[model samples]
Target: MSRALFAYPKQAQFGRVLPKNKIYEHTSPSPALKALFVQQIDQIVWQYKLAPETINLPAKPAVPEIQIFDITLKTAELDHDVLRCIDKAIPFPIIFQLSHDNRIQTIATYKRPSEADNNKWVIDGYFADDWQPIETPRQPLPVALDLQGLYEQLLRRLLPLPPREQEALKNHVERLAQWHGKHNEYQKLQAKLNKEKQFNRKVEINAQLRRLKTELEQLS
Candidate 1:
């Protein structure tokens, strides 16, 4: 299988500190949102600019340019709302590299311009990979026909579900979202089954879990 993690090209580097307040100014985040940024985040940097000029990939309407943000964290985990806030502030698609305690993880949500309003973008659910050492080796970016394709490949790397043969990116992401729901259902059923003292209730919960497992497998 091809490696999902990537090492971006040198020509694409755009190292610059992106002030947290700059994002807050654009988005007007609520107090709780500001707390997440102040407590969990240490710094944000614009690490790469994967545009036509930098990467030689033609831009599509939905994916004109991809920004890579490298965020160093105060803790290991970050709220997805923090990422969504940054996405709302910027017009382009973004890929995040989060660093903490000498480890790094890549995360992103499938984002695109809203069909009803070209001025706004729609952000789908978040996906992330397990953390690895900062020194971990990475594969080169995937070969693609355009920036849209590259963005799809980058997001695909973080997705838990692999795309079905010839599946469009939208359909694949939808299936992954379905799998998340089904998997959650299965987990809840399993927990209920384990905690049930009555034999008959355990049997009923087990049956539901089996059905959910099948649905999850199909979605996967």
Candidate 2:
């Protein structure tokens, strides 16, 4: 059941600071803000050309934007890819971290837990569990360009897709859109597509997805 896992647009830049509570409470949210954010996620994917997975799913919208990472561990000698993830790190607290190379080095600077965070888990706070790996996002390409190229990937068609297929896809995409790159995006998405165990479709979809993201980057 291994499948491709690509969330909409990649998560915000690896170490960028997220806005505070007062921000989301704004009276008028930016139009296409979601679209623009998704586009950024897509750009990160294209930039890295990753397949997607559970570990790097930083786009979890619920996760805060800013965080620190620690790269002090080493990938097992048994890892298949040595050059995977640029480093072994993720932003601390809510923000997630992704590495391009598995050889990533884990930094040891960790934040000390505070009594306030322990008492008020309601607000965003750092936790040791935050280090656990998560499922990668599963974002697919729109149908229009899916048939052709990135120039016209029509997201509309995906709306009324054939039966449960569309429903499942929509649900998954919504959840995945929350984070950035995948810890192992490829493995997750491959298990979910066309009932086949593969990944090129993700590549094809990502190619198209990236094209749309370029315009958004300019705005961000």
Candidate 3:
């Protein structure tokens, strides 16, 4: 994965503190989720807003604007549900920057409008880069013809694999989701194979494992 971190243009900075109550008001989060928010999160800032006014890119239907949120964490790890809650509260696509102990990591889900309901958005899955020092040099935002194109490039940076030539962003995200499913299945098969004591069963498990490995290679 190339450097996924980016320096937002100063012109795009929002620099407003977003209170937890505001999110709660919009989301009406469950009690458990609310507790998680209070325990795991320290603060949330509406760090940057990428729009036609700020970035001078025409907005696409699904991506009118991209919001960058800076989240200060109380713990090193944050539950995905926390992010899900925020995404639910906000209608627009979001890119999350997580901060912990002076280190930062970028994370976002493949979010887009639902085919069945334009008012609703479907979040495919979360993708993240490893944490780095806060002062790590950041790359300038990728040049894009429109907000949708800019969103695609930003999310692509977090994926483990590069996009195939002329591939749509949705297709790229689907491919990565498939890879993750197969990877998890492979790990489970390996665990089952390790626990199998019978030689006959071992051979069967090994054969299945080899087949899965081949599939994984093709996906990669």
Candidate 4:
């Protein structure tokens, strides 16, 4: 915590003059509504690799130029009635411009909470930096859609490892995942393949059958 935050000093009791009051409101919304909105914005953040930064804002974000990204409002929770009723409220990265009446106007508006703590307003000036790809490893998107093909692709990348190496790698990977608080399904499989490739081994079902037959013949 900043010393300014913890120290009030002699008589500045109404609270120190931080511009935080001029920025976004931090009131908690309904849990369901809050989760619904946050998830939608977080998707955009991940897709665009948008770096989250906190800004002190009070009003809703202003309107900004139209964005090219395809943002569908298909989630059942976000609809016209649920969203449009708030006054001057919109999502972030909005563009506000001076109008003919000498008043400012927003060309485009997003009005939902931002990608950060879900409380700040994203200003056009702040979002001016072009977006980059999100390169860091991320948890797989929860099973809202099919991921079989994606998982297969990852497996293909791992199928070259040898048996012993695969075993060690798989165990190592599982242990690493345990550190992160959850098991990663695909990574574990990848680790196995990596081990197999390292040992130059491949499982052959017919060969295993022939081995069993030889063992029975020896017993006979």
Candidate 5:
């Protein structure tokens, strides 16, 4: 049997296993209300698994608020379990990381049906290195939603770009994302260099830092 792990906000607690029935009694009247309820659920799940009374996970995560499940299960089976645990009407999004053979092979998102669409069990994003089309797919793996226009508008509001500068804005955002990723790598390397006692290893890390700095300059 595959194991499924979940993360909730820190304020809530769950027993040994998550309940398969609806945990919240009140109905959400609006999308905002629903989001708040889901946030609470996320917080509860997070706290339940990490609290001292429970599993007591490490205080510092490689990435915070993301809990990795130790149990392994088929993708279909795990999705079924997650759906059973969450309310259908609430429309909360849950992310799942599927692993096998000591490596995560797939990352999938399970979300409730949208008000404008009729399709159920839509997989928003399924990323894998060895992805192959399922001949008899159980769920619909639809194309990712395109929010470029909305994203552009938000960027414009934040930066107040001049008219007819769409391409420039796109390039700027892409470069910003690249720079942030490189900056993270730079920080990790700096930490490693500090702890590394080997002279040869320190030399290699210094070379990497020089390359990263050049890339950062290009981005700037």
Candidate 6:
């Protein structure tokens, strides 16, 4: 019989689930519970026809368990609600079998000690095959970032730069941040322009648009 999946807390005790009222407190899972979850995840991998090698299951029950799921090509574009459901159901780190452009990639999402602050959770990397670490650091929880920002930071870290080049890159990043702020302003102006039917008000908006466009061009 298939076992029910449990939503384990990140800092929970090793063996068993904490009481619902005290869920946020740090605790660990028991050895038996860890083994059972690992077995259940393994069974799911088999049922989905996903390669077991893509998953980086711990060699021993002593290690923290991570939930694994094989996302097939057909289901690669899973809707937001479905993805949210999956995320809610799984307690441990999640490994995804992602298919894109006829290529199968193993993407793992595991929590790591936050560099900026220790008492927070951060999804550090998207590991490749054999759990090879990918440097994709993200912001801490509660104030999460969009995937675009995450991938942008990943791409930025792909190569090392010289001292002077690093300085230039830092300036460029600052400029990009400014551009994003201006972009938000531009969007708001466009929205206001769209709703305002009065000719005089439209003329004022058009002037503001021209100035914002000029600033954006300077940034570019």
Scored by Cα lDDT, where does model 5 land? 0.40
- Could you tell me the TM-score of candidate 2? 0.17
Best by lDDT: 3
* Candidate 3 residue spans exceeding 4 A from truth: none
User: Which runs in model 1 stand beyond 4 Å of their true positions?
Assistant: none
RMSD values for the candidates in order, in angstroms, are 1.6, 20.9, 1.2, 22.3, 19.3, 14.5
lDDT of candidates 1 onward, in order: 0.91, 0.28, 0.92, 0.27, 0.40, 0.42
TM-score of each: 0.95, 0.17, 0.97, 0.17, 0.32, 0.34
Model 6 per-residue lDDT tens digits across residues 92-176? 3344544434544444433333567654444432334322223323223111133222223332332122122344433545565
**Residue 188 in model 3: shift from native, Å?**
1.3
Question: Which 10-residue window of candidate 5 scores lowest in summed lDDT?
Answer: 60-69
30 Cα displacement, candidate 2 (Å): 45
Better of 3 and 5 by lDDT: 3
List runs of model 2 lying over 4 Å from the truth. Answer: 1-11, 14-73, 77-92, 95-220
| lDDT assessment of candidate 2 | 0.28
Q: Candidate 1, 204: how far from true, in Å?
A: 2.3
Residues 1-220, model 2: lDDT tens digits: 1121223344422433333222224323344543333333221221221112422332222222223222222222212111112111222222123333332211111122245553222222111111223343334632221211221122212221222333443343333332223323433443444464448765775555555455333222
Q: Which stretches of candidate 6 lie over 4 Å from their true place?
A: 1-97, 100-116, 119-154, 157-178
Q: State, as a TM-score between 0 and 1, how close model 5 is to the true structure.
A: 0.32
Deviation from native of the Cα of residue 131 in model 1, angstroms: 0.2
Which candidate, 2 or 6, has the higher lDDT?
A: 6
For candidate 4, the TM-score is 0.17
